[model samples]
Target chain A: MNKTVLQIIRFVVLVLFQVLVINHIRLGGYVHPYIYMLFIMLLPFNTPKWQLLVLGFALGLTVDLFTGTPGLHAGATTLMAFCRPSIIQLISGNQKFENIPEPNLGQLDGMWFFRYVLCLVFVHHFALFFLESFSFRLIGQVLLRILLSVPVSVFLIMMILYIFKRERKRE
Target chain B: MYNLQRFILKHHFVILFILLEVISILLLARSQNFHRNSLVNTSNVVVGKIYEWSSDVGNYFRLNTANEQLAEENAMLRQQLSIVYDTASCVYDVNEGDTLYEYIPAKVVNNSTNQANNYIIINKGARDGIERDMSVISTDGIVGVVTDVSRHYASIMSLLHSKSVVGVRFKNNQEIASVKWQTNNYRYGIVEDIPTHIVLQQGDTILTSSHSKIFPEDLMVGTVEEFYPTAVDALNKAKIRYATDFSTLRHVYVIKDLHKAETDSLKAKFQ
Candidate 1:
């Protein structure tokens, strides 16, 4: 499949899954995992920075439309996309991505991919929760939500990636 | 001039990032104000249609609970029918032939309680006689007030939202107070401005007071769970478990007050 077509398919599937399935999963109201960030995380390594930010904004806006929060997600996801290149550099250290097309379990070692996902997910969730609250008055609750939701979101994203990884391996 | 142009060209991505962030923040700020009809929201026709479709699937699984709730409300309304009441002749000043409020039934197309500023979208909108600032209530208790409406859907500012406040009073004594959700907990809210003189019980019922223009007086709000006097104001604040389980809310009524315009105009005179 063409790369753009594949990404588009992934985008639609992930957004629908996030809205219809993940948004309905409320574990004590604290574990609202935003696995939609996976779309931005899985973009190809050589994708342009401007495209990343725009796509991030679009994805978040789509979610906001469904959730009735106009720009909370958009703001957070845009910030995450802006920080993506720096986070990747900070995590990968001297490792080059000349051959690696995307950051996935298939291309990267488990530990490195885990660390990459953890850092980016943290950035996304932290921004998202804080922006959603938009006040320090409920800082404690917001912080708790971030702490509880990040691991769950990461786990869900990793499970999804693992499924993809197994399919590719079988092929 | 050339150097400036070069700087702009090199840092275009950074500039774009800043611009997008500013737009996002502006939108966030605008949405925080409940009165504004934001350009992007669940009440948008396309978005509401998508949620309506999804809720159609989701509602099938919740039909048992939804039916039970409707049955309960039906039983209660049955007891209030004129046929069930006894007629007595007395010198009573009765005002006849006036309908004070009208209710438009709506289905909860989408609702969220996990967010700090939660909102609910109902299937009824302008086309169905729904309007902004109308009170929304479930069979069990008060739900929210309509904040935005499109042609086919209306968005409600849920009582669980941080900015949502309701004027409520003790059902026993009519002592007025206001309920506000200070935390993310949807099951409970904080009651403010209770008179320190009134003795409160553990399970006192709180009902909406007449002070509110949107909500009709004496509507069930919640029950008092715990209370304490504030050190600064010497006024009592209490925690009340909300009567409406926002998490399970599916059906609601959008109430239209027939005399709201007159009441609003009268109240606006004092201001």
Candidate 2:
């Protein structure tokens, strides 16, 4: 019950933050960070596949609702959710998920967990910026948006995870 | 039926994932339609209301700059007001076929300049008599055209968008050409189809051509930053330094061309 409530709260807060605050940010005309994908990244290891896909779609659609870009976010987040299991197995050497109720820095090695988040974020952002551009003509600009946005978003997600996860674990 | 049910149960997750993804791609393509189905777009009531609230707070911080811009425009208008109407100028001519245009003031509540297809959201919409294809302009120069509108909000396809095309000409010579964004820097646009024989010197003033009723004749567009002939056939192409700084745009005017219906109906007869 506590976990379900926390996830719901995170979803609401992240979506509001993304639309209200981060959407307004225009850092040097590039770094538009989207940290809302952190919700998908932190889901429990035993999460049902159908539920993961639905949650990812919901998150992306909520963002698309505000940004006015239809399907760009939804497509990218769904792709991330679809590929999450493969990425996890590659990172942890096919370790059984039963040992880990949730994929966190506490259970997974720090470097491995970092790599997992980095890869998923890259895939998510890659699909997003490319789908948004949808043309090879502006490949330079699209690559620039991805390169700049990914690092900023990753850093923010990691900071939030550390702070929030530690507090939750204490309780 | 039994076999199909077993297959569905086994691969339900994969099927759902693919289904959602396909739906998303379709939505993306639909949004790109030329008609721009506004119902599914950002101009919808719920999202539009949220943006309006956010812009209300954001517009406060920009009050000082907006005031300065309005003051500067007011001073310029005041100076023009003092000028006696010149009978010699065509603008003053009361010809039978003359078309009159009216302006509607609006605030730009949401805008993006970085995208390949940039769009602006204004505070006025259908209730304000804003119709599709009406030209939007800032105090300085051309801004964009209205693509879609709901009850109280409208979305403009900005001049910086890759697909935007505006008819323009040289202020000094009246030599006409069409300007289009080349999906590059927002500060510049390319003027295509100028004849090779014409010499376009740098820093020449460009203005909206009278060829189109969308914009009034001789409105400032931009100055020529560079000009050259295409390698293939000596076709003259000039790069224009756009007048409106879209990044800082706040307020604008939507023009209603009163004679549009008459002219359009007349032109349709030629087809």
Best lDDT among the predictions, by candidate number: 1
Candidate 2 lDDT for residue A149: 87
DockQ (Cα-based) per candidate? 0.72, 0.60
Interface RMSD of 2: 2.2
Candidate 1 CAPRI classification by DockQ: medium
Error of 1 at A171 (Å): 6.5
Put down candidate 1 lDDT per residue, A88-168, tens digits, no spaces. Answer: 999889999998788778768999888888988999899998888887877888899999999998899899998889765
- Overall local distance difference test of candidate 1: 0.86
The residue-by-residue lDDT of candidate 1 on B34-133, one tens digit each, is 7854686334898889889999998999899888888988987987754434342243323454678988999998898877778898998899998889
Clashing residue pairs in candidate 2 are none
DockQ of candidate 1 is 0.72
lDDT of each: 0.86, 0.83
- The candidate 1 chain B region of ten consecutive residues with least summed lDDT is B86-95
Model 2, stretches more than 4 Å misplaced? Answer: A27-32, A94-101, A105-109, A136-145, A162-165, B41-43, B84-99
